[model samples]
Target: MEQRELGFTKIRLPVVGQGTWQMEEADEAACIDAIRRGIDAGMTHIDTAEMYGAGEVESLVGKAIEGRRDEVFLVSKVLPSNASYAGTLAACERSLERLRTDRLDLYLLHWPGSEPLEETLRAFKDLRAQGKIRHFGVSNFDQAELSRAIALAGPSEIACNQVFYHLLERAIEHRVLPLCERHGIAVVAYSPFGSGRFPAPDSMGGKVLASIAAAHGATPRQVALRFLLRRQPVFVIPKAARAAHALDNAAAGDLRLTSEDLARIDTAFPLGPDRGVLPTL
Candidate 1:
């Protein structure tokens, strides 16, 4: 799999990773097997969150990565409601316990919360110092919120911004992406297939993707993920609760699209005007 640096840090991560958003709804053994399959396929950047299934998802991830923890780069998020200094610390500890891991590869504030940003950042710094987490970042933050976060934490300290980015939602390209690029912060694209809104194979955009995927001997899902990775510093985390889907998503890491393919995709799924609207967290 292709790799990119996380922010300005020395840590490099796979271009494609695994997301465990709604995996809790799937069969427990199957979900665990899916994650293990993804890891074996080199999609070792496993992302989960405390908010997911009220921490049950984290426990599942823990089981999936039990003996293979060192082989994966683990990430999790603290809920916005837990963004306060003490809350963030407490939340992380709880996540660590649930994940059955001593340290996280990356930890993120789920989104902008009512708590002071500095307080949360302070907790992140302390966590890093204590070896509780290797790096820290944010998710679903708008340009202004991201800028404030960078100012508070320093550009190099903030690792990445996990956001909603797909053919249908390209608002971040206007400002958030540019800012992240300037600071060398990796843009971790969550829901690269639009969170269950992926176009059907017969749909216009889907047809374009299907054609492109066919040309490359890949799946439309691979085309969508590769589209996000067309940029130099972007990572994608597509969820796959089934082992087959996990393997399929992992293969996208090796699929590269041509310029013509990209042009066609662009025409099919134009980045409509940025209305300054951010996707829901």
Candidate 2:
């Protein structure tokens, strides 16, 4: 699988990772198998959140990574409701317990909350100092909030900004992406499939994806994943609750769409109005 640097650090993450957003909705054993299959296929960056199933997903990830934990780059987020300085500390401990791990490769504030940003950042720093988490980032932050967080945490201290990004929603292209790129913060694209609202087969965008996929001997799903990887400092974590889907998504890492393919896709799925609101789950 292709790898990209995380922020300005030497750490490089797989361009394709497994997202455990709604894994709890699937069969438990199937979800575990899917995660393991994804790891074997080099989709080793697993992203989960405490908000997911109220922490049940983390426990499932813990089981999946069992003895092979060292092979994966683990990431988790703290819900905004639990992002206070002290709440952040407690939440990390709980996530660690649920994940059956001592430290997280990367930790993030799920989104801005009522707590002061500085307190949350302080907790992140303390966790880093205590070897509980290697790096910290934010999620679902808009331009103003992101800019403010960066100002408080300093550019280098913030590792990445995980946000919603897919073909139909390109609002971040207006401001967020440029800011992250300039500050050397990696951008993690969540819900890469747009919550399963794929274009109908008869739709123009659907036909375009099909044509491009046929050219590359790929599926429309793979084409969608590849389109998001066309630029640098951008990566995706699409949910894969079954082993077959996990392997299929992992294969997208090897796809190299041609310039013409990209141009055609851009036309088919043109960026809509920049509403200035970064989509969040």
Candidate 3:
């Protein structure tokens, strides 16, 4: 895998990262092995959240990255309910405790809750100011919300946005993508494979991804991941607790899709309807 600089943050991140949404749901040894596989393959960015398995995933990730901390760009998020300044400060301490780290490379607002945008961005700015986090961002935000967050963050701060984006889910392109492009916000794409919605090598959605995969001798998931990586300024974190699956996601960074393949995939999978939904931070 290769590294890419995060927009404005100046953080060198991997193109394809590992997401630990359910790492602990799998056996411990297997989980650690999968993480090791990802690092061995150069997938250095790992994303997690405080609510994920009630902090079990962060603990496991902490253990996995224990000796290889410098090799990984560790990212975790504070829940929406904890979006306030005081709550965010406490959340950061707890996350650091659970993650067994003193500081986080990136700290994100888990979901967009009902809180005012300014309130949340203030918490992020505070976190950045105190050196609790190297970068701050929002997840599952719509175009308008992301624009607001960017404006609130100002051009001085690196405010990346995380959201669901895949070959089957192109809704981000309609508004969020352009807004991020206008500003310098890099996108952190989660669920790049649609959570296995395009699993079959023979289905329209799956075949479309696989056709692009064959062109690069990659899997459908890899093709789907690469599609997102090549889409503007985006990085993808596809989760897998199995070593083989983790390595496959890492291999996506090694594959390069041609413009023709990119166009084919883009047209075949146009942006879907925007529900104007923002996950509750």
Candidate 4:
């Protein structure tokens, strides 16, 4: 599997990471089992959030990584409502407690909020200075908001900006990708399989994925995930609690899509199509 440096961070994140948002209320043993399988399958990054099930997700992830935290790039975020300076700081401390870690690999502001952007960025910078977090990032922030934060935050690195980027929802290509390209920021793609919508041919991912998956005897999920990995050095987080499902997503790293296949996918799901606007990336 190919790895990419998370912005300037020394950590080389894998192309596939495990997402913990939907695993909030999941059974403890089951969640641990899934995470264990994910890591064993060579997924080194994990994403979670404070707002998910009122911090239960982080707590479960913390428990899952009891002795293996050092091997994973653990990522957690504060919710959008906690965008104020003090609020964001307080939320980070809470996340640390719930995650049972003194420092985080990556900490993100969940979304663009009504509060001033500096207020949110200040909390991130101060946390980094205190060594509470190794990397800072944001989720669901549009391109303009990202630019404003970058300007206000001075020269500090913005490690990752996670958003929905799938065949059905490719709006970020116009708004987010160019800005990210300019600033050397890494894009983390969530819902790469289009959020459990029509799997392949019926969905915007199109028949190219199906044909490729058939050739390799893999599933549509792997094909879709690899598609995102092929575009712009992004890490894809597709949720799966079952071992078989996780393995399927992980297998995408093994197969490389051809140029013709990529072209077919792009044609089937154009980036800036007005008629088929994807939700957000």
Q: Please count the clashing residue pairs in each candidate, in the order shown.
A: 0, 0, 4, 1
Candidate 2 lDDT over 50-142, as tens digits, reads 999999999999999999989999999999889899999999999999999999999999988999999999999999999999999999998
Per-residue alpha-carbon lDDT of candidate 1 for residues 75-182, written as tens digits (9 for 90 to 100): 999998999999999999999999999999999999888999999999999999999999999999999999999998875888999999998888889999999999
Q: How close is candidate 3 to the true structure, as a TM-score?
A: 0.92
Clashing pairs in 3: 80-281, 111-281, 112-281, 113-281
- The models' CA-based lDDT, in order, is 0.92, 0.92, 0.81, 0.80
TM-score of each: 0.98, 0.98, 0.92, 0.93
**Deviation from native of the Cα of residue 221 in model 3, angstroms:** 1.6
Name the 10 consecutive residues with the lowest summed lDDT in model 1: 272-281
lDDT of 1: 0.92
Ranking, lDDT, top scorer first: 2, 1, 3, 4
Q: Candidate 2 — which residues are off by over 4 angstroms?
A: none
List the RMSD of every prediction in angstroms: 0.9, 0.8, 2.1, 2.2
Candidate order, TM-score descending? 2, 1, 4, 3
lDDT of 3 at 6: 83
lDDT of 3 by residue, 1-281 (tens): 66787877666778988888766678988888898899889888899999999888888888889988877888999898887767888888988998888888888888778667677678777777888788888888787777677677777464588888777677777788877877778888887777756657666767787777776777877777877888557999888788999888888888888889888877777766777654321
Stretches of candidate 1 above 4 Å error?
A: none
lDDT of 4 by residue, 1-281 (tens): 66777765657878899887778656678778888888888887899999888988889889988899888988998888887999988999999999889989889988888888888888888999999998898888786778877888765478778988886677878767767777778889887776766454665555667777788687766777777777664789887777777777777767788887778777876676534222552
